[model samples]
Target: MTDTQDELPQLMSHQSFREQAREVIRGMIVSGKMAPDALYSAPKIASDLNVSATPVREALLDLVQEGLLRPVRNRGFQVVIMTAKEHDDVFKIRLLLEVPSIREIAKSSPTANQMKGLYDLANAARQFAREGDLIAYLNADRRFHISLIELLGNKPLTELVASLRDRVRLLGLANSGARSHIVQSATEHFELLDRIAASDTESAAAIIERHLRRSRDVWGAGSGPA
Candidate 1:
């Protein structure tokens, strides 16, 4: 190791460093600061994060297992690239899983506080869209939709949805070049919230499905495998 590498935090038996490193790297990838297909060098990452390369290497391995990154033969890791079919498959599963959960929440008639929280998140997403903050908008959008499903009180289902969401974030960030897309998403969010607040489970489910479909369509049109 170089002198700089020697200065990094010593890797103890604890696992928190690896977890924190994974989150940091994942955030960079999700936020578009780290381009897809770019090589991930442990030394560079350690230098940038001011940590030992061991945690960065461990985190990269974890991401690879999670399908977020892939190891190249005789080279460093690279961010995973998704085909259009993969993207469609992901969204299809999301619709199948998440739509029903949201419907359940609507049917259960969530408390006023719950509904308010969802609407507040939607409003924040819209504000981010209006300001052209794609990262904030995407994060808030995920929070709103995921929170809706979380209210259904299914731990396994929520875990599955969260896993799918990581993949969705990749596609959303890739398609952030189009401004109109954000506007359309914001409109859909408002409509969904309105339907939910009215306690219309059927309409809320339909609207949520439509939103996911439209998102797939728009993202497919913008960036997909050839």
Candidate 2:
């Protein structure tokens, strides 16, 4: 086949190519495949993903809006390096929102279905931890938190918290020693679940605060703040 013909598949498909590029690049950034402070462009990434430049540019733009990336002057996009302060800031906001939300949820009490869903999520996190799957563990952890806030039935709040969680993940703060740290973090989920299930909002709030503070310290050490 000619060069042009050979590149046909690389062109945009009828599917959501933009979303695909976004997800692919996102995976690279969050997985540490694309190091922080590294610079890339739409064309460069397009070659990597075997897609056209249009969708790649669109995808990068989306991440820029999400605070995961920044646009360069004449170059492509730069992976925004997240500092320790940024992580702490996000965690502080999480503490503010999550603590009160959990307290409210505790007061109202979780229904049987909500309780079951949370247990399932916590179990998934534990399973991922045992298997040494950091990405899966983080995903399960995010879901657990998001699902709890979802109990409030506030769409905007849920979206903001989820966005902050994603940004935090990109900071490479989830790194840990081994199965032990993973297991400990995942176990904390079950403990928190127990509190919420029992409608102990006060205790749950305290747990939530301590969990976040401990995570901030541990992850801060791994990332070294800068």
Candidate 3:
């Protein structure tokens, strides 16, 4: 009898807008435009994104569920950053899951079309990095890595890896002054693909191992551990 909007949430027609707002805000947080120390209001974010407040509210609530943010009652939400130990643990888990798995991709018969698409994403990622657009860079980088993981044909594995990636808190990447490191990291994508194409499994694995390490060691460099 209490199945009203008062007792349960509803998914209305504005789902796409909510998703858009969520992705944009998430990108901002991940890119370091929104610091963990600050509180952000849905109305304010909607104003900045030029959207209605309702969708932004829904998006903000979603982020709360994902643990990227904490609700601040009437004020808004505060960004949540992972502890150094948590970040380090996530990095170790990713290393275990991603590095060796790359060998399977290198051994598989990936189509030329697939490789071309990945190369395009790699180039886009590189350009985004060079321009210092951390949001765009992370977007492209996420897609590149996820796409590579998808080639393994394991949906659960793909989802697990993606979830792990999402667990990373924003490390203020935009102001990290990691210009040289990011550029070098972006270029590593191409090297990964090249190794995959050559069927050099061990080499691909090594590249990815180093690549994964840098996220914990260098992506947020000059900050605290991990």
The C-alpha RMSD of each candidate to the native structure, in angstroms, is 5.8, 5.8, 7.6
Global Cα lDDT for candidate 1:
0.73
Top candidate, metric lDDT: 3
lDDT of 3 by residue, 1-226 (tens): 1111131123245558898777767776666667788878888777666668999899999988877788998899988877767767877899999987898899895899999999999999999899976667777888889999999999998987876776664555535456766788899999999999889999999999988887666644455454
Q: Over the stretch 89-201, how does candidate 1's per-residue lDDT look in tens digits?
A: 88889989878876777788889998889888989988988987665566677677778878878888877787787776564354544467776788798898788778899
Better of 1 and 3 by TM-score: 3
| Rank ordering of all candidates by lDDT, starting from the highest | 3, 2, 1
Give lDDT for model 3. 0.77
> Which scores higher on TM-score, 1 or 2?
2
What are the TM-scores, per candidate, against the unseen true structure?
0.75, 0.77, 0.85
Best by TM-score: 3
Per-residue lDDT tens digits for candidate 2, residues 1-226, read 1222222234356569997677666655654556667678788677766778898899999989888888888976777878878877888898888889888988888899989999999999999889976655765777888998899999999989878867765666445554576688899888888888888878989988888777666653567355
